[model samples]
Target chain A: MNVEQHHSTWVIILSFFISFILAIMPLPDWALSWRPDWVALVLIYWCIALPQRVGIATGWFVGIILDVLNDTLLGQHALAFSLIGYISVKIYRKMRLFPRWQQAIVVFALIASAKLLGVLIHSLFGSPEMNQPLFYPALTSLLLWPWLFIILRDMRRTYRVS
Target chain B: MISKEERKLVLRLIVFLFASIALMLTDHNSDYLKTVRAQLLGGVYPIQYLVNWPVKAGQSLSKNLNSHFQLLGENANLRDDNLRLQVKLQKFEDIKNENQRLRRLLGASEKLGERVEVAEVLAVNINQSRRKILINKGLSDGVFTHQPVIDAQGVIGQVIEVGIFSSIVMLITDPEHELPVQVVRTGLRTVAKGMGTVNRLSLLYLSNTELNTSIKVGDLIVTSGAGQKFPKGYLVATVIQVNPDIGKPYAQGQAQPRSALERNWEVLLVWQLEPSTVINDEFKTINSQ
Candidate 1:
């Protein structure tokens, strides 16, 4: 039991690390705005799978690291991710009972809210007008959810992460 | 009744949200957290470098795959370009000496040649509204905030934030950026404002009331060195379009920046010739004379 717990901890950390790398990878100019929120999606998955262990605090920490990497206003991603974390943890039980497609829709709504929060923070800081296309990332994240969910779920079961 | 676990979750969320707001407020309002931000960015530097490694490897791999004939052609073209530049340098050397002699006769200080350090581009901001790029050089490399950055073609931008091992450059095409420029043909001074377009800059403060404002399409614009932030006479942009708005006090003009702002892999960070105060005093002396 002790060995399993230790392995699961490493697995969770390794997953977050990979997500961070994906989040910072350079994208072509035309596809930049369409880049998915890899960190957020991963954080949501962990929050759902390990609600007791991963929650708002983990999200806040990861979000702050992302802000540092992106060189954006501090706490902007932190706030958004924390909100996503809270919502996911709140609904994780009911969400797990739903079909995979329904769960993906929930992920869509969660990520969309996070994007909205980011836009709100940017506007509040008096950033120049961003076009409506800023929401492209949320759409891409939604499309990627099902595949990511299946992969992560299999990994969890195979490793007995809980 | 709400469960204890739910209540604790709500409480934790509130706490984190409040902390986030507090952090955002402090970051936006002042420079108090600049040190913290810089140190945190230092931690992120290694990860960013690792993430960028694959792209760099791919670029080199493609270069190595080029045919020998193509390599020979490229080498020959580079050699020809070098010879042409050396011929131009000879003329510049003579002109520079004459200019220095004239300045000495006028009791004016000689303008020193700028010292530059090279830095490699690491990442670019994905946001279209914020035209920024991150480079590998930072405070440890003698880079400082507001240092002018240029590529071989022309001025690209200025360093805005310096981390321990990386820095952010705000490109000339950012909407918030403005630089003083002078027309090469007519010597008319004007402020060039970034138009959020890579190739174009807008000339501001040009009053239509000024009769025969010599600015026209295809006029060359260079730095005026007004703020002493940019060295004097660097190629900035060229006027592409000029339209006098009917009944308006100001005319609108657009210019294409000389720098290939978005494409360069390496740039030079230039240390300004003189401090702002010293430059201001020199300007005053020149004007009084």
Candidate 2:
């Protein structure tokens, strides 16, 4: 059991590292606003699948890293991710029981909340006007959730990662 | 045990939320975290490079896949462009000599040659209103904050933050950006404010009276160099619209930026000239004379 848990730790870190790459990957000008929130989606999946191991602290750490990556106001993503992490942990058990499509809806809500929180933080820093297209990433995140879920699940099971 | 775990989670969330707010407040209010940000960027730099590798590879792959005929055509076109530029270079040399002679007569200090370094654009801000781009050059490459960034056409932006191997450039079209500009035709000075649109910039501080007499559509606008951050006399934009407000004291005019902010793959970072020291030296020379 100890060995299994230790191996699963590598899996979690590796998943997050890939998500970080996806988060910063360059998209074409037109598709930039529509690019999915890769980090948030990955954190949500981990929070649901391995609630005890990954939770609010992990979210905060990842958020800080993302804040540095995006070059935005520091801590803006941290605040949003912490809140999303809390919500995910709070509902992880119920979320695990839902159908894949229904889970996608939950993912949408979670990611949207993070997006809204980010906009609110940005506005507080004197940029009050929000762009309409900023919400497109949430939609893409929702659509990508099922595929992400399946892949992460397959990796976890194949590796016997708890 | 489960209840204890839930309580711990709640406690952790509160702690993180508080820390985040504190960090945001400090980061926005001052430069205390600039070094910290730079250090953090060093860690992220490798990941960014890796993330961008595939795109670079694909671009080279496509270029390599081009037929011999296509390469020959491109090479011929480049040769033609080089010949045309050579002809233009002769005229520029003559102008340079004439300008130096005129400056000597006026006792004005000669303008120093600007040091320029080319950097490739790594990524653009995903957020629509921010209008920033990340470039591959940074402090290690002698890039500093407030260095003017330009493309083949004109001024694109300025470097706002420099990491170890990367930097962030805030484009002139960002909503938060404004630059001092002058009309090349009339020499009318004004401030051009970004209108959150890539194609347009708005000229501000123009009185309704001056707008009528001094400004005209199609007038070329260039940097005034008042702020000492951007050098004087780079093509910035051209006036496209003049709107007179009946009630307001100031008339509104929009100009199109000359730089291809969206399309350029590479940009030039120009070191700033010390305007104050130059002015002081010129004054000393005049007083001695």
Candidate 3:
């Protein structure tokens, strides 16, 4: 497999846009409250998959878009996502060496951190305090990570540089 | 090794962090971010509509099915239903005529108030912590910020956030939400606020000393019109619990709002009268006094 076969910047951008759509879909109230931060999760997967190319800048930009769409105070999500992306890039080599299950756990913690960061920022601005359903989405995303990785792994295998 | 490229990446991180901090500060504290918010939301609108396509389809399918059932009923059964409806209509018209005659005798306005536009609930954020719901109405649909929203049961919520195609409502059960309510049993008025408990709310600072009255369970509560946030006479809730203490000046009572607040299909957004006129009218009355 060659690096040239990997998805280009444009392809990643389009994929993120598609993932954003999935994130904002009007799921039922109960289901929506539990809907994992889909775009962030997807972005994290890609950032880990291709750390050299899509770095903190990509995360910050996409997070801004999410903030705007959700009508949140701007840059709140941007800061969280960018920080996670930076941390992921910094540890990409060590993270790659970890077992896949361990990697999923790391991703779970990182996503939870991003969500808590958002809650903290909102609360500081006098928004009413909300109980954090922190563990539910974290656990669900961790459980789903392996299947998501497998599907994307197959895509990478199919599009290898011959 | 801290290579030059790595240094550049670190520099990028610092720059972005600062930029994000600046943006967040401006967004939360200043009025300048609306232009940016508008532009970003405009860019995202196309994608939002595309994502919302399935929701619209599901709604249409349900509506079509309902109409189909109405169309497929037996003709004889329909005829009998029409006759029954006609008889009821005649009685309703008679009552309406009597009401109008009585209103004229009293020199009352024929129209009670402003008309309402019906809207559908498109999405709801049930984050128990931040209780907000979004409906498929916008400025284009004449929905403004702070408009009172009610369902067939009663006052469901109020519009707190508005966008181009949809508006978000903060429900009465939301922790930050409060409504001025009057006890129908005794005409005592107090502010009712969400207590962060589902199906429960508390009336704040109700002094039991002023009026030696006992409030029982199942007593009705209506809007007090004290703060002018909600119109007078709208049903707010019913007293579910009354805990009175002999020593305390105020009693802690709980009421369950008339609206389900959690689950409802349709809601009506009430357009309030313009505030400037209300303020000017108040000024005139104060000057005369």
Candidate 4:
């Protein structure tokens, strides 16, 4: 209802918007498997930073958008993303205390779990058989976490997102 | 966190989890959510276009960066190819006329009712696990589910999902796709299944005992118009490998798709000839009689 409040909310929405673009951007065949799960990574960052404001509801909605974007099942990503959001929200305090490298490790575990949930859901519908390539996106998300965390943190600070 | 707050969050999580699982089950088993997905896809279009904008700019910039010599060489080659194609077209027109006459003489019903419209590949799905590409054509362009798509080379795939302004195409190389094809040389029919890789399709359901000697490397496989999904005579793939053993149940073969499925930027959306054309053909055949 507040004009200023709506403007600041744009910051969070914009971050998710950019993440969606990166998630769908066409990559050359050689680099495709290693593409980071941009939506999941951004969802994790927001859940950790503003747990109450950007937790399960945000993840679930963004995930529905992702499901449509990927043209997979309507709720395939919604389910995974809500789970990611809940986990991050519950563990936000501990994650904030950890150093950046330690945070990266947590990021790896969270994303790996999310991807595992994805594979589980995929198997239910008989798509995307579990293979070595399934591991690469999570690994790439882990490798990108340090830089992404700082960048998003700076954006949140600059925009005073919370 | 307060116990009440924690309980609320956990409760919300369960709700979301169950809701999504139900959504997936229904979406997979039926088309109940097609309109919802189409509307959602419309909302997602801005992001797809935003991601494509820079890539399109880069491509246009690179196009102008070609040297004069290269342009001249390309022009000369194109001219030569156009001439050659025109000669082939002349033969094709005559052949079509002769075939139509033969069909009339035999009192056969009309065939050859396919049309094509051009579309550009807008974005490839970032999820490499699946072989889906988004094309610029959609419901607005009369694109529909199961419509055949092709490139200059041969059959590429078919449209799977149609949004308001764009559609998603599942390439034939996807593990989920199967095309019914007939061998040009031997008339042996079989279904080709995608092996979840680019440029390869595996022949399925060919009886090894009878089809073993017919399939060979370099043989051409094409649509047989079995299920009316694709029209007959579209080149689907060329046989690259064949191994038939009495020990195995079906004759085994691999095919190299004729289209550059992953690389082509432009494709043709094939449409069955309109009913008016059928009427015209019928009139022409009656006049011949």
Residue lDDT tens for model 4, A1-162: 577668779988999999998888888778878999899999999999999799998999999999888887889889989999999999999999999889888888888888888888888787757264666888888889999999999998987777
On a 0 to 100 scale, what is the lDDT of residue B71 in model 4? 94
Which pairs of residues collide in model 2?
A: none
Query: Model 1: residues >4 Å from true position, as ranges?
Result: A1-4, B109-111, B123-129, B273-289
* TM-scores for all predictions: 0.90, 0.90, 0.77, 0.94
* iRMS per model in Å: 2.1, 2.0, 2.9, 1.7
Error of 4 at A56 (Å): 0.8
lDDT of 4 at A22: 88
Residue ranges of candidate 4 with Cα displaced over 4 Å: A128-130, B104-107, B274-276, B281-289
lDDT of 3 by residue, A117-161 (tens): 888888788776657577777777888877777776565456541
Show where candidate 3 strays beyond 4 Å: A1-10, A21-34, A68-71, A155-162, B34-56, B59-112, B124-128, B208-214, B245-249, B274-289
Best by TM-score: 4
Clash tally for model 3 = 0
Ranking by TM-score: 4, 1, 2, 3
TM-score of chain B of each: 0.87, 0.88, 0.70, 0.91
Off by over 4 Å in 2: A1-4, A28-30, B97-111, B123-126, B273-289
Candidate 2 vs candidate 4, TM-score winner: 4
lDDT of 3 by residue, B108-221 (tens): 653333347788775433233556666777766877767889876778878866666677688888788999888888888788898766677888877766335746678898
